[model samples]
Target: MTQKYRSRARNLLHLGSTQANENFNQMVSSKAPKARHYGGSSSLMNRVSATVLQKNEGHSYLAKDLESIPDPIKLQNFNDFVTFDLETTGFGYCDITQIAASVGSSKYQSYVYPRCQISVEATKVTGMSHSIATNKLYLHGKEVQGKCIRTALLDFIDFLKEKDQPILVGHNIASFDVPILSRLLKEFGLHREFVRIVPAYIDTLKVARKVFSKEEVNGCYKQCNLVEVYLNIKYDAHVAVEDVNSLQQLFTVKLKDKCTDEDVYSITCKSCKESYTDVIKNKIVSKVICEKLSKDGIALQHLQLANRRDPNGLRVILREHGVPFKKCEDLARKIQEE
Candidate 1:
C-alpha cells in the first residue's frame, strides 16, 4: 500500500481540475438531456448548436435568432406607415408645441414656437411653456430653441417626402391631432403640400379598439395604458418623441398583422375620409393579399379583365406574387362570382 501511494503521488500533484469540463457537460445535458431520445433526431444538432452558442456568446445569442424570424404580416410597403405624435399648448384653438414621427429606424422630431399662450392644464400635462418677454420655448422647465410654426411644418413636409407618400399614424389623430394639424396647415397655407406628401392617416385608437377586446385593454385605450398592457413596460408618456416610439413598438408587435389598408383614411383639403378600394370593400381576400394587390397596382378592373380572359388566370397571377395557394383560390373564386 505504501509503494502504490508513492508511485501515484507525482501524477496526482500535476492533475488538472475538472470544473470546466463538468460545466460544459452540464450545459449539454440541460439542452440535449439523457432522458429524451434526441440522439437520433435532427433537433439534436440544433440543440447542440444552441448550447455551443450560449457557451461562447452568453445568453444574448438568441437576440439575433429572434431578429431573423420574419414578421407574420409581410407588408410590401411597410415603410409607408409613419407613426407620429403632437404636443400642443392646449386643446381648442391651440398651437402645436412639438411634432415627432418614426418609421422603422428613422425618426423625426421638432419643437415649434407657438404664437398663443401655453395654457396651465396643457403645461401640466406636456411640461411645455413659452416666455412672452423672451419669446422662447421651454419643455420640462428647460429653455429650448424652437422653429416657428411655418418652418416646423415645412420641415415635417420634407421629412414625409423622404418616404413614398407616407401614411400618418397617431393615437386619437383623427379627432384630435389631424384636425389640429389640418387647421395649422391651412392657417399657414401649407395644406395642399401637406396632403400631397401624406396621402392618408391611421388612428391607432380606432385600431386598438378593433384589435383588443375591452377586457384585454382593461377598458382603457389610452396610449400609455395600451403600451403597458401590450409591451409589459411603462414609458414616459405625454412627450411627443417617446409617445411615437412606444406607439411604433405597440403597432409592430400587436397591430401589424391585423390591420389592412381598409383601416386607412384618406387626407383631403379639409378633413379625413374613408377611401377603401373596390377589392377591400368587397372583401375579396386577406389583408396581406389585399396589400400585395395594391402594391402591384392590381385593381378590381384588372381582376375582371383577367377573369374574363381565363378563369384560372387570376389565381396564377396571385400565386406568382407569393400569395398562398389557398388565398389565391379564394380570391379567384370571389372575383369570378363578382
Candidate 2:
C-alpha cells in the first residue's frame, strides 16, 4: 500500500480501537516489559493499587477515572508527544549531568550534579567535567547550575506530569535514558510513584534505524546516533536540550511518518544493523567532505545529504569545495542569497 493510504488506515484503526476502550486487563502486555520488581514485588501492581485506592494526594483523579483512558498505542494523532535528551557524567549509567525535554513549545532543561566523578573521556565528549558539574560550571556554550540527581529526576517527572504525561520521545532512550531514569527513580524510592505518571515512549533512535535501514555512509553501517543523523545540523552534541531539538526535527521529518500502532517497545532493533548503518553514513558524509572532495558533485546530487538546514545545500557543498570553515560559512550565506 502507498504510504499515505497506510497512514490513513493506521489512524482509523487507532481511533476506532481507542474509542472502544478495550479492557486494560484484556490488552496483551507483549509490548511492555515485565514491571520492575521493587523489593520482590511488582511495581506496577503497587502503582495500580495506590491509584485505585486514592491513597495518593495528586493521583485521586486516577481512582475515579481509571477506565476509558486511552491506551497509548491506540492514539490516532500521536502529536501530543515530548522529546527529551540527557547528558551524563560517564557511561557507567544513571550519572546524569543534564536533562532536557520539550513538548511543542514548552521546555524543561537543567543540569544535575552526579553522584560519581565525571570521567575524562565522557567530559571530553560531553564537556561536562567533574569540576564544572560540582562548581556549577559554565559548559555547553552557557552557564550551567547543578541540581541533585534525585531532585533533577523529580523536576523532570514534574515536568512530564505537568505536560499530561505525553508520549516520551528521545534518541537511544530505550537503551539508555529509560533504564537510567528507572534506576534513579527506584534508588530514590519514587519508582512506583513516578512510573505511573510517565507515559509511553517513542525512541527515535530505534525507529530511525529500522526505517532507514538502507542508508549507509562510506563502507560502514550506521545506527541512530543523534550527532550522525543530524550531521548537517550545526548543533553541539552531548547537550541535552540541543540534542532534543535535533531529535524533534528528525522525528518530524523522518520518523513520524513511519510511526505505527505496533508497540515500538516490542519491535526489537538489530544493534549490528543500526551500528553498521550509522558508521557507514558517518564515514561517507565526513569522508566525502573531510577526505574526498573530488566526488563532491555526485555526492551532493546522489546523496542529497543535509548538514542541518543549509540554504540550497550550501554548507555541505561548500565544505566539499574545500572552503575553510569561516570563509565557507560566509560564502554559504552569499550562495543562499543568490
Model 2 per-residue lDDT at 210: 64
Model 2 residue 114 lDDT score: 70
Kindly list the per-residue Cα lDDT of model 2 for residues 1-338, writing each as its tens digit.
Answer: 48756645522331223321333332323222356444455565655544333322334445333222122233353446788888877775548888898877889998876756777787787887655322444474465666767678788878877765367788778778776776666545565556466535677756766666444433222223533645556677677888787777777776777886543431112221232344246443333232222211122322222333446565655655555787557544533443
TM-score of each: 0.58, 0.53
CA lDDT, every model vs. true structure: 0.75, 0.56
Alpha-carbon RMSD of each model: 24.3, 22.7
Superposed by TM-score, candidate 1 places the C-alpha of residue 156 at a distance from the truth, in angstroms, of 0.6
lDDT string for model 1 (1-338, tens) is 78876765543432334675677789999999999999999999989878866764467767732232111223344457899999998989998999999998899999887778999999999999987645678888898868777788899999988997578889998778888998877655577568657756778898899989999987999999999988997988999999999999998898877887556654541221122255566665565665555443344555566778788776777676567888888888888987
- The clash count of every prediction, one per candidate, is 0, 20
Pick the TM-score winner.
Answer: 1
Q: How close is candidate 1 to the true structure, as a TM-score?
A: 0.58
For model 2, the stretches where C-alpha displacement exceeds 4 angstroms are: 1-79, 132-135, 138-143, 216-231, 266-338
- Model 2's lDDT to the true fold? 0.56
